[model samples]
Target: MGVSALAEGGSGTSYPSHREPDGSIGIKLLEASSNRKNDPRAYLYIVDHINPGTRVSRRFEIRNTSSSSQRIKLYPGAAEIRHNTFVPAADRHANELGSWISIDRPELIAPPNSRIQLNAKISIPKSASEGERYGAIWAEVASPSVKPGSAGNIQMINRVGIRVYLDIGPGGDPPSDFRIEQLTPGRTEVGMPVVKATVNNTGERALDLGGQMWLSDGPGGLNAGPFRAQVGTTLAPGYSAPVMVMLDDRLPDGPWQVKLMLESGRVHHTVTGTLTFPEKPATWGLPALLDSFPLWALVIVGSLAAVAVAFFLVLAVRRLRRRRRVAQ
Candidate 1:
């Protein structure tokens, strides 16, 4: 896991680009468990493991980035990992996890360019199931009332939130792990090269996937990127999904060495191989010659074989000299 500064309303940066023009609001996690201090996800979300019948509290901060004051509403909303995505339910739809959460300040008037801190308390029942749940702590702002019959007078609402991934169990926390199953090279409809790595969650907990890919040993020795893996892919326990990396469109197809690194929290995995993007635009290519065999592994095997052959040849020459000497 890596640590990053909490973004104002988005991922990684203090000021996000998608701020609403009228009045933008931001929310971020303010506290993380000491055990997970090094995990970046803990600073961006409410990620924790709690025992049954235990009570826990987490603090979060909200910001008003607009010139005028804004009224913000805070609550817990349902979320689920569907199709490898963390999907929050529509309009504050409630779930078991959301029901268990209680915010100390549900509504507040945030002064212009000011920040407010709030506390959320979660109480797990003794009979709670031994599994993980997903939800979000949301801060929302709605447009002020528009005059009747005004042009395009539709009121809009914008909300930003911190995700919550909570696991309820007894005793020790469940282990988190995953593996890269396969890699496929393809192109999007617009001819941009893409590599999709199939990943499987092979442990008892969910994973929020992130990583990077580097290309080398290309045609004419022309090396390419350390392109970033696309984010927002979450995998539930025992499920599989694709983590995609989109490469530069102008990159040439070649027998390029690919090094991919993927991680979630503290767990990390690296995979290396050779790949050539599909020549046909928008199509996925067949597996390359060394798709399954890594270049490093191949080099090591070849070096060992060469050493063995050289030793055998030396022995053969010595034996022939001994036979000739005996004949003489």
Candidate 2:
């Protein structure tokens, strides 16, 4: 069903608005509490609307209607709608809920005729595209008195969701985005480290790239670049460029953090990687050389060395016997 129909109280839409075949219906947006005295109602709150990031916090409320207490389970679910149909007006789909939004604490117990509130926070990706997204928050009732899982139980699952309409605008210069991929020791010595960063144009527009790498108090703690990148400058959407940062070998060895910074448009994004340096090489010289080779090669070389030693011992014994025979 179209998002607009679900929001405006239209009938015969594919999306169900309250009243499931099993007799469960979503809580209406403006419905009063069934437990008049206890305030058994549900509401939704959003922290931000424009930037389309996930770290938004959603809060819900439940009230106990019975004389004793009630236990409630809040299920966090999510569903995605296409970006095209999202409209900011009230006429858009308001109740087309997504899966239950995930909550840190899933269950709660309310005291006799008491009210309870629950909150869930989700991490939104910065790369979320601009568009209309729809999903629901489900509050399921689990009190034993409600026939515990019965369809007609006073314990009910209420659903509410927001229609997120994000518009970042079309056709602007793309933003430069960068992330650190790997960092490690480049040579066997205690120093000399190699760091790698992947820079990309995550936005819809092309980006002019300025990037740098710096070591924070560790192996080869040196700063590389604000390099003028040639490949990353005109990156199309989702294209990436790999840049390597090299540090001098004489730098001290220890735990180190590497940072990569990229500038595009008016913003800069920094990505980081962590690495540790060992006090010494695990092995050295011939023993280390053999250890570094493949197991089969090491076995063959060791076998040849054993044969050569046996042959030399046999020849020395024969020569000593011949000398003794001449003396006799």
Model 2, range 237-305, lDDT digits (tens) per residue? 456654445555555554555555655433466655555444464311111111124344568899999
lDDT of each: 0.80, 0.41
Q: Give candidate 2 regions above 4 Å deviation.
A: 1-54, 78-101, 142-328
Consecutive 10-residue window with the lowest summed lDDT within model 1:
1-10
What's every prediction's RMSD, in angstroms?
9.7, 24.3
Q: Write out the backbone clash pairs for model 1.
A: none
For this target, which candidate reaches the highest lDDT against the unseen true structure? 1
What TM-scores do the predictions have?
Answer: 0.80, 0.28
Counting clashing residue pairs in each candidate, in order, gives: 0, 17
| Model 1, residue 301: C-alpha shift (Å) | 20
